[model samples]
Target: MSTLDAWTHGEHTHDGTTHPVYRRGTGPGVVVIHEIPGMTPEFLAFADEVVEAGFTVVLPHLFGTPGRPVGAGYVLDTVRRVCVSNEFTKLATGVTTPLAGWLRSLARELHAELGGPGVGALGMCFTGGFALAMMVDTAVVAPVLAQPSAPFPVGPTRSRDVNLSPEDLAVVKERAAGGCQVMGLRYRQDPAVGQRFETLAHELGDAFVRVEFPGRKHSTLTLHRQQEAVDRVLGFLDEKLRA
Candidate 1:
């Protein structure tokens, strides 16, 4: 069952673009990265728990699927949106992606508002590895990569890529060398994340902890639905944010 709590919704700006932000509670700040379907109710419910745990939560809806205010038939709409929302032709080639830049701008905004030097960041599923990339900024001190989607390359090579860009991986390596801990979770039966992705778990050395639930699958977030997991996440935030 979800916590079913309401969040204080607001908007923030970055790179001349505005993004939706849902938040509540008051204390240290934590950024909650959404999954594939964007900022759905379930994801917000999870953020609510983070707020209730006593930290202010900031969740960004990066992709502007504007005018989607209602959750009516959300499951189906989300499916179409995630799987095949756009069908336009690619007229141009090799356009530099803005994801990494946008993420950094968001980190700056949160750090400024929190009146702090560092803040916590979490990325889930499609956005899982994003948190690690955010560590490129020293302000992103504690990073959580939950059920991180396997980094797969596009096209023929098809080898499991860590998904993060080479430059960003270098940043993470630096953070790990500086003693920052990275934690992650994934289901045992998730075909999306194979032994290859496990290389990421090994790459972090002892700094990374991957917890496995034997019967769990890809949707571990919705499977166990454990209150204790939320507690542990909060504990992690408390430990990282306090000192």
Candidate 2:
């Protein structure tokens, strides 16, 4: 059986949409959104680390097989699904994917049940920018974007867009302006991330704390799994959710 078989699974529903969510640990809440190809072992390991760090980690299975390995076939299947799904903007720029709204609702519900300076959110890869979009709601205070790649990074416009709707972007800007900072991680040479960090810096000003590394390493918490970045993420969570 897969390691995910041991995680407590449930469904989180919002606006008539329900997604499977795997939760573990207790105390402050921290939603850890997975990357492409489903909730792989690497992603689950990262979630376990967050749980060990003393927060209830929620991993929502948005796509792909729940516990499938990362292979070319799995990757292609997930990519195709995301491309056709209305939940994601896929090729669109300057528009928040409709799925982000549901995620925000999930964050709000989690926070309402277990409160401590609000809940934390960490989105990686395809779902990386989702945490930023979820920040439009006050419940998500600790937002972490790990190599956020959405809208496919196909062209210049999509590369620079943060994947947020105009109204949601305005709310994020206002929140950042009001002292709610957002953390981000990316490799300087990772094409998947495009110019997202540059756009974030331009939009969020001093509120965006970026931890950029050299080379083409991707996925700060998994796959590449930089120890320093992982520690930084846990530290950020502690500071935001614990203290």
| Winning model by lDDT | 2
Q: What is the lDDT of residue 190 in candidate 1?
A: 58
TM-score: model 2 vs. ground truth: 0.97
Worst 10 residues of 1 by lDDT: 87-96
Tell me the TM-score of each prediction against the true structure: 0.79, 0.97
**Local accuracy of candidate 1 as per-residue lDDT tens digits, 17-82:** 666776677988888887655665566667777788778788777642422332446545664554
Please give the CA lDDT of all the candidate structures: 0.64, 0.90
lDDT of 2 by residue, 1-243 (tens): 237766798999998999999888998999999999878888888888888888988888899877677999889988988888888888888899899878999999999999789899999999999999999999999999999999789989989989998899999999999989999999999999999999999999999999989999888888889999999999988998876
Candidate 2 local Cα displacement, residue 84, angstroms: 1.0
Which of the numbered candidates is closest to the native, going by highest TM-score?
2
Runs of candidate 1 exceeding 4 Å displacement = 1-5, 63-97, 150-159
- C-alpha RMSD in Å of predicted model 1 compared with the true structure: 4.7
lDDT of 1 at 70: 27
